[model samples]
Target: MQTIRLTDLIAAIEGTAGPMGDASRSRRPGADPDSAAEHPTASGAVAKESLTRTGDRAAKEGRAPSGQGESLPVPRIVTDSRQVQPGDVFWALRGERLDGHAFVGDAVQRGARVCVVDADRVTECKGPAAEAVLIQVDDTLTALQRLAGWYRCRLATSVIAVTGSVGKTTTREMIQAVLSAGRRVIRSPRNYNNQIGVPLSLLAIEPHHELAVLELAASHSGEIAALAELVRPHVGVVTGVAPDGDSSNPSISGDGRYVAFESSDRK
Candidate 1:
């Protein structure tokens, strides 16, 4: 249904909000803004239509509506071949146990509109799959993170990031329900609090949302920092610190507006 423009995504990943960025209300501009928009690049090329969705969104829904040429809406993103649908972007992730690269052909066969691959594995996408738009990145994981960050920066909605060893999810849910009681709110779905999961959550944000409450979970070093860099929350919340809780506190944008929580157990 809704899609972010390819040009805007390029500018965001590059850390430069370009002309298209100024046009779209969302950080990741949608194709509907300028269907005729064209961007010729070697690494990340845009076809007649320039739009993409987060993997979570695509998997949760069925095939998207189709349009003609430049008027075409951006496709949804899917990491699994089984979820691939017409006008979908398949992110080829390389995990320790399995490599997504192996399924590029399968994705294309299933009607994927685009595919993200590593710089070294471009050759893996061949035959009919080559017809789909190819987005090459130094690393798919990093690309996914940057794209999420790009989308996060474009939002005018207030962002509330919560992190802790325990009760992070519970705290987020409570905050979301209370805020949503009055405002149009969007919060992280389920326990999506990791590198890949977080990005998908961010990408799920739509234009009408007024508030965003994202829950952050960190088990290793730099995880919180990475989330902070991407979200740059206006309000940072830290629940009670448990033994397995995230020691790294959420960082704010330092725009002179922020909120924090202590033990919440006032004696």
Candidate 2:
């Protein structure tokens, strides 16, 4: 029926610009100043449709321009085949026990507009879904991360990322509730603070959103740092520091304006 087109929402990004993070910037800054290209870990190279436009830049790169010409609204991004819809982009993520590639056909049958798959599985990407855009990348998970990073750089929304050994979710919720009183606030959903969840949370940001409070969770080293590069928050809050467990929560804030960390002494 009715959809919120990027053409309409894109105006919100016109004059707003700031340094988000290196992870969020486009890999290749082309002749067209507005075009953004993504470099997924699947391959060191850019994805065929990663370019926002389909002009000389696309021709020079020998790929079709994707994000530029489509007046049709870009649909929501989803990982599950069951959630696939006519306009949604289905990411076929591979899990240890369950391979998302197996459900590609199901996603196509359900009317997915784009299907992201592993580069090695190009042969399997056939039939009805073939008509939809097939973005072949080195890794679907990394592609998801890159896509979120690319989208984040285009907006001027203020980001506050929360991470710690404990209480990250509670802190994030409290921040969102307080901020929502005056601003249009966006926050991480449930425990969506990991690799997949963090990217999805960033993707949910709209042009109208003034603040984004993302709760980052980590059980190991470097996980928070990796996620921080994606968020590049204006404020980073670490709920607590674990004396026993290794915590990367503080490191996840990057070079932001403010970073709040708890003392090692547990009160």
The clash count for each model shown is: 4, 2
Residue-level lDDT of model 2, residues 1-267, one tens digit each, is 113343222221121123233332212211212111111111122343321223334322323235344354555777777767776767777655466788878887887665667777756675545545565666666666666665777767888888766788889999999999999998887757666677778888888899889887653344565667767777778776655423333343333212322221111
lDDT of each: 0.57, 0.57
Task: Give the CA lDDT, 0 to 100, for residue 173 in model 1.
Answer: 94
Question: Which residue pairs clash in candidate 2?
Answer: 42-138, 42-139
Which candidate has the highest TM-score of all? 2
* lDDT assessment of candidate 2: 0.57
In model 1, residue pairs whose N, Cα or C atoms come closer than 3 Å (at least 3 residues apart or on different chains), thus clashing, are 4-30, 5-29, 5-30, 165-245
Query: Which 10 consecutive positions of candidate 2 have the poorest summed lDDT?
Result: 34-43
lDDT, candidate 1, 1-267, per-residue tens: 137754454444444553111111112212112211111010122222222233222211222323222422354666677777877777777655456788888888888777777767776564435556555566665666666766766667777888865688999999999998899998887756665566777777787988889886654444555555566677778775544232343232221112322211110
Candidate 1 lDDT for residue 230: 64
The per-residue C-alpha lDDT of model 2 at residue 162 equals: 85
Off by over 4 Å in 1: 16-72, 243-267
Q: Give the TM-score of candidate 1.
A: 0.69
